[model samples]
Every structure is written in structure tokens, then in C-alpha cells.
Target: MSEHLTIVEHPLVQHKLTLMREKSTSTASFRQLLREISLLLGYEALKDLPLTEIAIDTPLTEMRAPVLAGKKLALISILRAGNGLLDGILELAPAARVGFVGLYRDEATLKPVQYYCKVPADLADRPVLVVDPMLATGNSSAAAVDLLKERGAHDIRFLCLLAAPEGVERMRQAHPDVRIVTAALDEKLNDKGYIVPGLGDAGDRMFGTK
Candidate 1:
């Protein structure tokens, strides 16, 4: 697969994202907006899915119907935050195989440490969409992708609600073949390694956690 980065610029996505970015947006509202925006993001990500024809019965007669080619996709969520994008995408692609990769950054070392990983048995044959709301430092995101790659996931796509330049570059350097899809690409990462003007900690906003 070719390396790509797509910034979704739909009006609806932009509007909901603005509301979510407000400091005063509540957790419930944040979560709701994420679900809605994810639907739009998924649409863009799967725009070019290959199509194949199969025999099918229509209202009047039997005919060949066009359907997605290749095996069903594997939707891999990168722990808690990725769940937000996962849910909406699941609604869009309910037949997709679901999986999760749990990783946390060490406070001192600032490196990702895997805590959990469970994926479909057919992961190697299916294209994978890795979901995470924020791509900040990219260390954890790239690490999660590494785990999937080790499992034989060559066709991988990284999906996020927001992305920082540093994080995008990091992922590009590490996994140039994977496509990166996001609702918005922000300016930069702040001193604390947070996306500047991002929808604050996405997990915190979505789940009301500290």
C-alpha cells in the first residue's frame, strides 16, 4: 500500500469537532460528537474500497451484485480512547473483525508499554483499521501499529479524530506504508506532549476521567 495522509474537511465533521474542542464541552457531549464524527471519517477512509461482483436476486430477477472485494476488514482499537472511533466505525462496518491493543506510556521513559493484545485469527489476510482519537506523540500509536504488523497485518490504516504534526511525522517515519486518516491536523505538540488546541485529553473528555 502507498503512504497517504487524508484530512477530512467535511462541514459536519468540522462543526462537531469545534464543539468538542471547547473546554466547557461535557463528557457526554464529547462522546456523542466523537461517534458522529467517526461516521464521517469512516466514509472517507473506505472511499476507494475495491468492488467485486457476485450473483444476487433483485426484486425482479437474479443478477450479479457489486460488493466489496477481498476479505472483511479487521478493526483494531488502541485501548480506551480508540473505542470512541471504534464504536461509530463498527456501526458502519458491523461485519468487520474487532480487536484491541492496549498500551500505556511510561511516565519517566515516555515509551509505550503493551498491557493487552488480542486480535482475530484471520488478521493476516484482512486489511486493518487502527483507531485512536488522538495521535499526539505517536510513540504509542506507532507501537500499537508495530504490534499489529508483527501479527501479519500488512494493509493497515491509522484513524484518528485529531493529529499533531510531530505525531504524523513519527508515524510516517515508522510506518510509511500505512495510511493516516484524521478529522483535523492540528498545529503542533505542546510542551507536555499534548496536541495544541486539541479536544483536550480525548479519553478524559469522553469518559470523564482525570
Candidate 2:
């Protein structure tokens, strides 16, 4: 989590990602793949969580066991496609508090427009992970982070399925302290603000929309 950007290059992650990128992949399969890949990315993203030792009684003996330190984690999904990643991560961290930031791009300007936002209280005390499937233009992701900071979330990390260099740079310039974790870094964004060679529009494919 200390690194500014971490690409999860695990074999399983890459394999499923390949399936997701295929145009002929069915909606059911796409959604399933997203869920599976999410678990892998979630594992990498949460690896650095702080741990503290606590005394516990094992069936055989008493010992100090390590457990997650501090408050429960806060997961803020960036609406729509973010929910796909959120579902699998929830299975991994069922105790985590969940929230959502609703944003959509302005077709002409390619800027984020917030429609809804509701997050857990005391964000300053918990570790926050913002989930989104794609970091295409980075406008929405950066803006989402801005809103979280305004709500007092300092320890924040960003998790995505794919990232474009433009999006990564945008996040770095906008919020250098936040760590970014993704499955892959594609070539570059297309003119229309989509990641080149990405798995199409994540939300569209996952939800079976146009």
C-alpha cells in the first residue's frame, strides 16, 4: 500500500482479465470474472493492513493472536461498475462498512458530475478503499477522492480493474498520498476517454447494457 501504484500481475488475475476483454464473452461470464478478479485485487490491496496481537485462548492453549488493528475498514464504491468490485471485496471483508459515491461523466466535457453520495461516519478513523472498475479519464475517481477528503478520510486507497496512464497520473497529481491498485495498466486512453485495449465499458459489459 505504500507504493503509489501497484499492478497485480498474478496469473489468475491476468487470466480472468483476458476473458473479460473478449468481445464475445457473455454478460454472465463477464460479471463472474469481475467478481473473481476483484477478490484477487482485494487481497493485494489489503495486504498492508496494520495488525495487533491480542491474547486468545486456543482449544489447545492460550496465545497472542494477530488481528486487524484499529477500526473496521470503510469501502466506498464509485457507483455503478464500482459495485461489481465491491461485491467480491465484501465477501473478503464482510465486516467492512460500505458507502457509495455516484458520479457520471459529462459526455461532452468528460468531467465527473456527482449525483449522490453517502458514506459511513467517522471516516477519519477507518481505513478507506475506493472501488472502481476503470480509471479511464480519472476525473470521476479524483473527484470522488476529493469528496472523501472533505469528509475527513485521510487514510485512503484506490482499487480498480484497469488503469490508463493518464488516469494514474491524474490521481498522482491530485492526491499523491493515496495508493492505487489495479489488475492491469493498458496502453493509453482512446480519444473518447476510454482505456485502450480495456475490457470495453466495465459497467456496460457487466450489466449487459449498450
Please list the residue runs of candidate 2 whose C-alpha ends up more than 4 Å from where it truly belongs after superposition: none
Best by TM-score: 2
The TM-score of predicted model 2 comes to 0.98
lDDT of 1 by residue, 1-210 (tens): 234789999899999999999999888999999999999999988776678999998899999989988889899999989999999999999999999999987867768999999998777788789999999999999999999889888888889999999999999999999899998889998878889888788988889999
User: Which is the leading candidate under lDDT?
Assistant: 2
What is candidate 2's lDDT per residue for 87-188, written digit by digit as tens?
999999999999999999998999999999999999999999999999998999999999999999999999999999999999999999999999999999
Taken over the whole model, the C-alpha lDDT of each candidate is 0.90, 0.96
The C-alpha RMSD of each candidate to the native structure, in angstroms, is 1.8, 1.2
Query: What value of lDDT does candidate 1 attain over all alpha carbons?
Result: 0.90
Clash count, predicted structure 1: 0
